[model samples]
Target chain A: MTACVIMGSGNIGTDLMYKVLRSYTLDLRALVGIDPDSEGLHRAADMGVDTSASGVKWVIDNADSINLVFEATSAGIHRSHAPEYERLGITAIDLTPARIGPSVVPGVNLKDHLEAPNVNLITCGGQATTPIVAAICRAASVPYAEIISTVASNSAGPGTRANIDEFTETTSACLEEVGGAGIGKAIMILNPADPPIMMRNTVYCGLADGYDPERVVESIVQTVDNVRTYVPGYQLKRAPVFENGPFATPGGVVQTRVVVLLEVSGAADFLPAYAGNLDIMTAAAVRVGEALGAARTGGRT
Target chain B: MTAAFRLTDSTLRDGSHAIRHQFTVDQVRAVVRGLDRAGVEVIEVAHGDGLGGSSFNYGFSRIDEMDLIRAAVDEADNARIAVLLLPGIGTKDDLVHAANIGASVARIATHSTEADISHQHMALAKDLGMETVGFLMLSHMVASGDLLDQAKRMESYGADAVYVVDSAGAMTIRDTMERISMLKHGLDCGVGLHAHNNLSLAVANSLAAIGEGIDQVDGCLIGLGAGAGNCPTEILVAACDKAGYETGIDLTELLDVATDVVRPLSPNQGVIDRDGLMLGYAGVYGSFLLHAKRAAEVYGVACDDILLELGRRGIVGGQEDMIIDVALELRQAADSSDAPR
Candidate 1:
């Protein structure tokens, strides 16, 4: 049996560990935890998985035939520990936003690190949205792209806060992969004061020479639909379209708008074909996982 | 004193308004160098809140707080390195970490009503041997008397200076002068100003505060910060120099940095204007301006309407900054309105 270890049982830790345990692809080895909370430990124990309170020690002690070590620890925590797993012949998949290893969004820049022993799963937000960014870049056929993500303050945990730079860089890089060239920018915000709301990402595409807005919107919609099929939480709340022309709600209530404009720049260099660009990103991420023999941890058929 | 005044630049930390919190280390470092060369006395290089130990998008330096500070301090040998730490989100340990990593000063900022938060952090920062300043954001929400009380408490809490931050970037020049005068009378510590350009009044209000004998002024290069941003550091330095006040900044170098450094990273045509003024009118804070901008982008509504609507939604009068949320709602509304009809 191919054994898999999930190091650092925090928020993403708990969710991802359960997914790994339920997967038919690998045998669970240990659910290492650092939280003193007995409830989380008890839940892991109930799942019939061995649990440890020590962070790095637990991983060091139990390393044998481990096919993959999933590091869901806080950002930066995995940076020092990830190389250790790799040295021990264990393939490490880091879900934390720390720049521990190459960022992998499955569909975006997955191919870049396919052969590497370590991979960073990036942030949950990046995993869910970069593909759309890639697609939008392709459809708009633009020179530059900027992806902005807004999350309700309370919903964004420490992971989102500590590694803010890494989160933005990874997202930007992933989009750059699809835009095929030129610079990319990523912005992420958390509203600790706002009510609980879904994580949202807005992609603003700027081309060397502006393109057709209607075609860009259509391509963005199709690309988002394709990505959502693969990444469950990757729903397109507001695809690339014009906002606030005729439709809007009253002064208050939950209002969210995502606008995409196809304005030209100095020259008409590289144009985006949204669908094709998204295809490249999405396919790249999955391809990386497949190369590493990663199976559906969240119960893939 | 016929001398110049001191200024801190919040461009990177506050600019999180325009793009979310997605700045790279290269960009942040550039901002630091620009602010420093322009002769800002202190460069606040990270989140106005404490450093996060987890994954966050918009905040201070993304790299380790220590690393960002050390790098900035190395580049800006003459400028003091300051960081903002909000209460509840930051611990005493983080404050200590900031000091160890070369942070010369720490600003303990809390909502006007939540003065206790900054007070606790201020005490801790002082104990750690770091210069501490207390900032009461959203000063509009609290009465002058209450603000005076908070400033006095901050003075007692060991804060070297007390700042009345128009966190919403909405304070008028008159309002800023009045608050500075009140705080100066009520508190024993030096008074400082941190203004947001939401109402196109950051410079005016900051200047007003300086005229009232406020000790320090907070600004950004070309006001490239949250919402419309803060007072321009170069402008403040020049004004203080011209006014014969001791700003302790090199006006010529600052202008060079603004032209050569800041403009390349995030270019701005000019200072905060119409929309920013409306934000002040709506009583929205700068912290929420980015969110308002995002909501305008998302919902496709006029940013002015979103700001007004947020004001109507009881969002205008809270310690919490939720401008992005209001923007998100506007975006969602815009989407639904256009649905397949």
Candidate 2:
């Protein structure tokens, strides 16, 4: 089994630790953070995993046995630690927007970047929207794609709050680099509702005039099915809506525009189900980590 | 009174809704330059709904808002370029792009009761070294006490200022005085007001807010905006000047822009019509005026009923879809009533 260590003992790190513990191929080694009083580290210790408050240095010192390190820290910290992980020959799965490695959206482009030393999960918004963007592009020539991801306010932790700018830039770049869109725009919303709402994403893709709407819808359904393999809670809240003919854009009239609404219901592994934003990120990380571990084990397990 | 105040021009941003989000680059340059020359402190540019708001749902922009923003930024010499961003409609990335392209200020808007959502964007704006303003849209929907609570949340989130946006132009002079006075007393940062002219009280309400020591106020050139349009910049500046208030704006220059550039582009004179007045009476969102009208036609219901029902439900911005849903239900109710027993 491939040994994995979770860095940053916050909501995301703690949730990731729980998923790693349940992984058949990945053995949870330790949870590391800078705060000694962090609930995540305490919970990890209680769950029988090694815990440290010394941060990434602890993971590096004990890198001898660790095959994978999940960096759940902010973008700035992740940038400083990524080279260290590479030098130590430990594969890093970055959940931050440092973009130290190629962007990986498991359902769409995981296989393309499996051999890289480090891979970025982009942001939760990217994970939730890029697959659909890619799906639309696969069926038609999409010139522009914009996604608005609305998550419950309570679900967004300090880390998510602190990295809002990085989240947008990284997510938009991924939509183009990974999702195959000519231009990409990303918007995030933290809905402050009582009994916090589930994570919802609205995706708008502008296609050239005369593209087949049926083929595009089929591609989207296929992509949604693939993403559901790892994120079971991920599903279309409604069918894709389409508008035809000369729709006005800054870049001129598009032949067709498609609007897709999506929702992610968390598995409620560690955090509540309303935190589908957090759940999708951690779940996608686990899926990628397992794929890497299986590859290392010669696909035996 | 010698109390300094900042004036923001929303001709290009909020005004986009009136023109169906089709502000050409030349139009933006003309309007922004005119506002800049008039010594306006801040000029906002974007889709009427804000950045990333160009979608099939929100009327798609004739030109990309970023292009409009860039044009406005390039045209302005002394005025700070600001952009309005409803958190759900515009993302942090859009803010970064705006800043990179020369936008110096961001007005992060949310519903009056949902100020907590502004924390992320406001924090990011401060981190990026850009001035941040929290805009609470549909301000008339909540009480002054509730508004104070929401404004305090924005101040704690690193907003340099918080605005009471009369999104529906629904506030009276008394409503403005109570809310702005309470915010002025409660907030550590500056308090601002954004009024629509739906009630024909935009100038009067703004004057009342200024009387309550509001540090900032917003207006659009020639009142070119959604609904009955915004407070007319020239008239507001002229009125402020007459009231012994110091806005530092060149009234003559503002008036010239209103007549020469903005007045020509206005689709209709900024006057309160039956539908526009209903927005104020019902306390509905100003931007929802056009959406409600379209939905009313599509669903075969009275537009006035949609606005009234939406207000009663306390529906806020970012809930545009609900407009159609409400209209459909109203249509069904009417259909059942007309059917044979």
Candidate 3:
């Protein structure tokens, strides 16, 4: 198994640990955090995984054995650690909004960026929506794509709250570079509903005049299916709806487009099922870890 | 001597929400020309959701807000052009363009509890060498102390002034006095108050805020705004005149602008209909009125029920997507209740 270090022990890092524990091609080396008394590290230790309160320094010392590092920490932390990981010759699968590396949504550009030192997994909204935008772009030229991501308010902490602008900037940029849209807009909503809702995304692709609806739907479904293989909970809420629009955007006019609604339910590895935001990140991380690990071992995925 | 305050005419910004954000260049020029002639100090203009806010979720703008801002600037004699920006919805690029386009002020808005999100935009506006205001939307949702903490955060981020926005139109006169007093006491920057009339308290709340020594206040010509509309510019000027506040606005001219400019745009903007009243009663954001009505109709759900449910969920501004979600759930609940147990 390819040994790896999960560099954060928050909900995301802990969730990544549980997901790695189940991976056949990946080995969980340890979960690390800065706070010595962090509950996340204690719970990880209870599960018999090696844990660290030493944070990034521990990852640096242990870099000799680690094949990959999943940076589940804040974007600032990942940004500081990115070049460090690069110098140490370790591949980092960044789950933060830091755009230091090329954006990767596994189903869309995973193999393309494997040789690179670090790859950003954008935000959960980006991983969930970019592929579908890319799919529609394949069938029809998407001039403008906008994605609205709504998650449980309870799940969003002050960190997430503070990074709203970064989240939008990063996700929208990925929709263009990876999803192939000419213009991309990202919006996030923190829903205050009790018994929190699943992480949901609404994607609207403003199509050019001559695109075919049948081809667009076909392309989107195929892409969603490809995503489900890695994320068992990724789902389309309904068939794509087409509406004639006079959608006067800041970019330009969108005469016609399709709207796709999606919801992601978590696998409940380390958190509740409603936290599909965290689940999609961990699932994508494991998928990347296994892929990179196989690339290293020259074995089957 | 009476208390004096600066007047901000949102007949162009907030008024866009009442008319579905379809303000043409001509309308903007007409209103800005009139308000500017009447000695109004600031004319806030943009798509109702703010700069760069035209989208599928917030509904698109007819004339680009930039072109509209240009028209307002060209026609104005004295009033400075101000643009409202919801931090994530309108990025720093928008602020730069508005500044380049001769807009004089930037009002960066965020939910009261989410003031930290505006740090970058507020600082960026200042960095662009333009004046900026921190607009705290849905101020009634938080306590006075919490609201002041948010205002202080904005002040630290370089806000020249901070405004408590009653996006819900739900605050009482006392609620208005308490929040504004805390902000005025805690903040070193200028303080302003924006009120909606969903509870028929728009003018009263503004008067109360003025009593708390407010620095600025907003009004719409004919009260042309979302929900039951905002405080009427004509009425506020007249009331301030009676209350001995030197607003510096020409009352007859302001009324003429209200009658000839805004009233034509929203002739029925004065009446507080059922949806308008419910918005205040439920303490829902005023902008949610139109979206919720559309959602209620699409799902065959009662608008009042949806508004109350949204209030119960503690919905805030910028979370407009939840209106559809709540409507769909309400529809499902309605369908299940119709079935045999």
Candidate 4:
């Protein structure tokens, strides 16, 4: 079994712990957090996984045993710890928006960056929308694309609040790099409601040329299915709405435009199921970790 | 009368929404000249949604916002130019670039409950040698305590001032008094107010805020802003003069800006039509008035119903895409209801 440690035993780390526990390839090593009184650490210890309150210090001390590490802490925390993981020869799957490594959306470009020392799972909005944008671009030429990611206010913790700038910058960069859009704009909104709203994304793309509605629709649906293998709750709200005419975008005007709306419901492991915004990050990280683990152990999927 | 509060004119920034983000360089130059002549201390210039707001979601600005900012800076003889930026829509680079162009003030805005998101931008503005103002949009949605907490977060981030913005124009005089007083007492930073005229209470709410010793307030010439418009700068100055408060502005010159420069452009600047009234009634965002009207015509739904439902869903700004989606859903509902039951 390939040994692994999940760092930062917060909501994301604990939820990731449950995901790794269910993994058949990755061998759970320990859950590390800075707070000794954290509920996430207590729950992990109760579930028979080793728990450490020493944070990155524990990972540095126990580096010989762990094959991989998941950085679930804030971007600033991950930035300082990523080099240690690299020096220890442990592959780091970064959940924060720290762009120390090339961004990897498993459905889009995970295979290309499997050998990198650290790989960033861009923001939740990036993981959820980048694959669809990439799929549509493969079917046509997309010049400009804009995405708005809305999440429940109740699901956004203080960490998420402080990193709103990082969220938009990382997500927008992912769209242009992996999704093949010439220009990308990202906006995030946190909605406060009684029963929290599921993570919903609205994507508007200005197709420049070489496009067909039937082909683009098929490509998008296929990409959704591919992502659903890891995240079962990811889905398109309905058929994408297409319009033919002059569409005014910041980059320029496009004669053909496509509007796509989708939603994600979480697996309800550590956080409420409405927090699919947080869930997609852990789910994508697990998929990448499993791929790296299987390759290390020489196990067949 | 002693001028008690610092006045910032937003005819260029917010008024861009009234003209669909199509402000020309000449228009900006002429308007800034007028405001500068009228002794307007700080004049704001940017796209309706702030810097870098031109996109597929919000309609594209006719000219680049940076060039317009440069124009405003060049034309204003005494008034310093200010620009607005929402964190998710505009980045720190935009702030740095604006400062390089001689703009001296940056108003970093966010939804009332989400001021934590504006911390970095506020700090960045402070570092850029510009005055930083933490602008909380849609302040009426949260109570005084909640608003105070958000304002304090902005203050801790190095914001020099914090503005309680009623983006929906839904705040009553009492609501205005409560939030302004809380911010004034709770934080070390100065407090400001940005009121809209949707409820026909823009002047009343500004008066309430001024009565609480607000350090700064926003107004647009002749109230030429989105939906029902903002507190008319001409009228606000006149009211300050009458209330025995000091505004230090030459009211006659401001009236010249309203009567000569703006009125010719937006003839219906102060008209509160059905759609405009629905914004205040349903507590919908003032900017959504245009988006909802476009989507309503496209989906064949009543504009008022669209605004009411968006208000019910409690969508703050930054969710402009939801306006079209909700309108389409309302259309589908209408179609289904018309079908055989």
Candidate 5:
């Protein structure tokens, strides 16, 4: 089994460690964090995985057994650590918005980038919405797509808060680069409601004149189903809503516009079910990691 | 105790809601030029919901917000271009795009109790070297002490100023005084107020907030905004001038803009209609006025009932979808009662 090490013991890192521990194809190596007092490190120790406070440097020093590195640190930290992971020949699955590697949304285009040295799981918003964008693009000529992702306030960690700029830039870039939209805009909301709400996404895509809504809806449903494979909690909050437009588009007036609403409930592995933002990211990372690991093992027992 | 006050013209931003997000590019250019000539320090331009907010749910913008921002920036020679960004409605990328197009200031807003969410956006705006204001909408929903706590969070997040936004237009003189005074006392950054004229008190409340040492205040030309409308920039400037406060705004130019540029664009003059007054009385969010109206029509319920029920339930911004659900419930209850026993 390909052994994996999760670097950073924050919310995303801890959740990823839990996901990695349960993966049948990838073995959990260690949970590395800078804070020795972090509860994530203690939880890892309790789960019988090796724990360290030395962070990625320690992971590199002991790189013999680790084949994959999950870099869950901040975007700035990931920028420095990415090249080191590359030099050490350890495949890094980055959870930060650093975008050091090609962006991958597993449900949409994971197989295309499996052989790459490093893969970025974009932002939580990208992971949740891009697949749907990709689906629409596959069926029609999408001129512009905009997404708004709202997650519970409590679910946002310091890392998530600090990387807000990267989250929007990287997610919007990936919508064009990976999801194949002509132009993309991303918005993120942190809902501070008590009994914290689940992660919800609103995706709006502008279609060229005379495009078929039925065909577009079919493609979107297929993509939603594909995402549900890894993220069982993911579901369409409502069916795709289409509007005939005098709506302004980058390429003049659009014939039709499509709106799709999505919600993600967490599996409650580490964080609460409200933290579907973290769940979707970690879940996508696991799907990508296991697929890469399985390819390396050639499906051998 | 007199302090120099900065005036923000939000006719292009908040006023978009009053017009159903249909502000044309030509309109933005004209209004912006007028506001700049009138000596308004800041001119905010975007979809009423902010950048990246043109969608079916929020009501699509007739023109893309970026194009409007570019137009406003091109027209305004002296006024600093600003944009109101609800954290969830617009992102840092949108801010970057706005800044690139010469938007010099960003009001990063959130629900009053959710100021923590503005931290990242505020930090990003600061890093980009733009003047940042943390805006707490629906300030009436929280107590003065709680509002102070939220304002302090924004101040800590690198905001140059923090605003107590009466998004519902629900604050009275007492409400404004207690909250603004507490914020002025507790926060290290500058204090600002954004008032809605739902109760025809936008000017009165602005005066009260100014009395409590608010450094900046927002208004729209001709009082064009959500609910009854925002504080009318022209009227507020006149009032400030009469009260012996210095606003640095030209009353003559503001009057021309209000009469010529803004008034023609407004669908109706900004006045306290029943729905508008009910918003202030019910303490509902100003932005929710349109959404609640639509839901009221869809579910065959009175808009007033929806507003009152939403206020009772403590619905806040980002919960726009709840308007429909509440309207539906209200309709269903009414239906059951109307049926034969």
Candidate 6:
């Protein structure tokens, strides 16, 4: 069985590789890592994985059955190399926010990518919230929705700046797909978590023109339950409440309050979700990958 | 005395925390435009974490050194463009870039009492021909006398002015006045005050600082800043006007900036709303407002209770963003059915 090859070795790379290794039940044939940092490469070596300090192309030659590659390098590096990696037979899963590939979230569009060559993971925030978005879409069968994820500023990292635009776009796309609609807004907030906080996501859903607000709220709550099944960190922060008044809705049209709390694992000092939360998001990704693989196999054979 | 105050808007830089660096160029331009119209003298737009910007914590909204200076150039053509360059996050090259691109002032900020770090930025600013202001965060962390010593040290290092930043928004008017008086008496340079409204005393404390002879009034328009926000430029300007202080700004435009600009850009968040008042009463620092708000969203708790609860948790000083952690803890405690509600 061919497992996705994860490249780069930063926070995203390290976590994604570990999750892929743990969840898939099969050993990743070529978990190649290309990093100049000796410490990172040493860590990968210690993990009993292949380490490639040379160019990415050199690593490509080592594997014959590369099903997919996950690129978790910095934004600048990912932007320059991700597209080329996609062109190769290996389907690239970019966890970095460089926005070089089509944005993807597991369970929402895992089946769509099994045949495709490459895809990008939207963001830690989006990955945590999109299922709820999809669940909202599934429940309401609405025409539109919006998601506002306000995170602790400490949670906003290098990948955040590198992929701000994509975060908005991917979130919007997920909302549209979930609602089976078009043109939704997704706002990501990076708040300075003083005592620092575990990362969390908030979703705001708006229905098609003149739809019942009650129905939308009911559907979103139901979606949250489904999401909580796999993502335990998810909690319904605020039950869907109707906020209709001046300045309630930014655009003056969408009047809905659907807030969900995601209590992710945090460092001991509560300095937001550092490497520990990265591990949780990565683990979720692997779970989705396995589901995708099963669905692909089940559908094909 | 002109009876007006100058505003140094930092929404593009400090406010980037709320959005993480995902702010669009359009958003940056929009924020700058509002601040400019509000008669803000200096608009600080760039990476709050500094020029080197870490990948894990840097917000995309952080304009590169040159780009940030350039983007803010048009909006602040008349207003002096300032960039905050953290010592470790920036280099001499960043100072040089800021100076070349028309940055009139470089607020060289460092942790309060950290003289070496302040001196490094101050020296770099002087070399680049930029007005070198030394900002000491969490000014109340030490006694007024101790701060006076640091202020004198900063002046000796070539700092044009010494800025007392209430990073924790924890100071009272007495604290501000005492700090300003000390700086005025001990240092040859001018004194400045950057107040946080976490205690709802930002305006009062800033006025008191000015009364004690602080020359520069650092503010953000409509208080669109980190924590409860800095003293609202309009409110501060009006108070200064009534008090007959000279700030070299138009009071009318400052009011207009609040009404038309900051109020709209950050419509519901960080305003002096009821929640903001609660935060102040609770002695929660300014930076924690957004996090508390997020926690409120996450825990299904009323946003009103977050600050008070956080305050009770002994989270104070510059640790404003930790309110969310407290909120999450409260949630966990409530969920376990073990602790008292």
TM of each candidate vs. truth: 0.57, 0.83, 0.91, 0.96, 0.87, 0.60
Candidate 3, residue B293: Cα displacement in angstroms equals 3.3
All DockQ scores: 0.02, 0.20, 0.47, 0.65, 0.27, 0.02
- TM-score of decoy 3: 0.91
Model 2's CAPRI class?
Answer: incorrect
Superposed on the true chain A, the predicted chain A of model 6 yields a TM-score of: 0.77
Q: Across the candidates, what are chain A's individual TM-scores?
A: 0.73, 0.96, 0.96, 0.97, 0.96, 0.77
- Over B68-183, each residue of candidate 1 has an lDDT whose tens digit, in order, gives 66677777767788887764344555677778878879887766754544555676787778888888877876677889997887888898898888877767777888889998
Top lDDT: which candidate number?
4
Please list the C-alpha lDDT of all candidates, in the order they appear. Answer: 0.61, 0.85, 0.87, 0.89, 0.85, 0.61
Q: Tens digits of per-residue lDDT for model 3 on A1-301?
A: 8889999878888888888998988888899999878778988999999999998999888889998999988988998999899899888888887777788888788898877788888888999999999999999988889988877766665677776777788888999999999999998877655578888888988888888899999999999999898889999876676767667655577788687888899998777888898888889989988887787777754
Comparing 3 and 4 on lDDT, the stronger one: 4
Task: Give lDDT tens digits, candidate 1, residues A1-301.
Answer: 3567777765455555545554555566787877757454667888788888887787777775566777767666787887788778777776666656666765456656656678776554455556656665665554544555545454444555434445556666666654453555555544333333344555544443345666666767776656555444344443344333221111111122235321111110111221122222223333344446543233332
Q: What TM-score would candidate 2 get against the native?
A: 0.83
Q: Candidate 1 chain A: worst 10 consecutive residues by lDDT? A: A262-271
The DockQ for candidate 6, computed on C-alphas, is 0.02
The residue-level lDDT of candidate 3 at A133 comes to 93
- Per-residue lDDT for B25-47 in model 6, tens only? 66666656666765567777765
Candidate 1: TM-score? 0.57
Native-structure RMSD, model 3: 3.0
Q: Which numbered prediction scores highest in TM-score against the true structure? A: 4
CA deviation > 4 Å runs, candidate 4: A60-64, A248-250, A299-301
iRMS per model, in Å, is 11.3, 4.0, 2.7, 1.5, 3.5, 11.7
TM-scores of chain B alone in all candidate structures, in the order given: 0.86, 0.96, 0.97, 0.98, 0.96, 0.79
Q: How much DockQ does model 5 earn?
A: 0.27
- Estimate, for each residue in A91-168, the C-alpha lDDT of model 5 and write its tens digit: 989888878788898867888887888988998999999999999998999988888788887888876665566677
Tens digit of per-residue lDDT, candidate 3, span B36-109: 88999899999898987788778878888899999998999889999999876787778889999899899989
